[model samples]
Target: MIGSFVLLNCKKNREKEVMMQLKKIPEIKEIQCLTGPYDILIKVESPTIEELNETITWKIRKISDVRTTYTLKINEEATDCKDDN
Candidate 1:
């Protein structure tokens, strides 16, 4: 599995619209409105890196209000931690 956190910068006053659009995509697992340089954050998962790339390039980036995106791919091994529960 491949997972990534995408930080999105959108055109002024378009955050909500962009978020709504992103929610329609199946690969986007989570979307959060943020208060910072970036307007929104999205968590996406895919079976392969190629599919993820396509989703980002062809789908996400195609949103008219989206200005830029910064993607951080998760490293499962480094992030794995046993739960204290």
Candidate 2:
């Protein structure tokens, strides 16, 4: 499966609204409220890059009050440090 992390910064006081909308998306496996430059962190998984892009563009980005979004696609071949333990 393909995976990615979506960093979102929405309008002030709209985090809850955004979270509510994000939860409804099936590809969204995890969502967390954040601080600093980004207000929220989203973890998603899909079978293809095209679907991942579609979800970002048509679903998440379509939500009202979403100011900015940055997506970081994961490299599935890389080994995680945790796996060695």
Task: Give the per-residue lDDT digits (tens) of candidate 1, residues 1-76.
Answer: 7999999999999999999999999999999999989999999999999999999999999999999999999887
Ten contiguous residues with the weakest lDDT in model 2: 76-85
- Candidate 1, position 4, lDDT: 94
Which pairs of residues have clashing backbones in candidate 1? none
User: What's the lDDT for all of these models?
Assistant: 0.94, 0.94
Candidate 2 lDDT at 16 equals 96
lDDT of 2 by residue, 1-85 (tens): 8999999999999999999999999999999999899999999888999999999999999999799999999986466656655
| Runs of candidate 2 exceeding 4 Å displacement | 77-80, 83-85
Best by lDDT: 1
**How do the predictions measure up, each by TM-score?**
0.90, 0.90
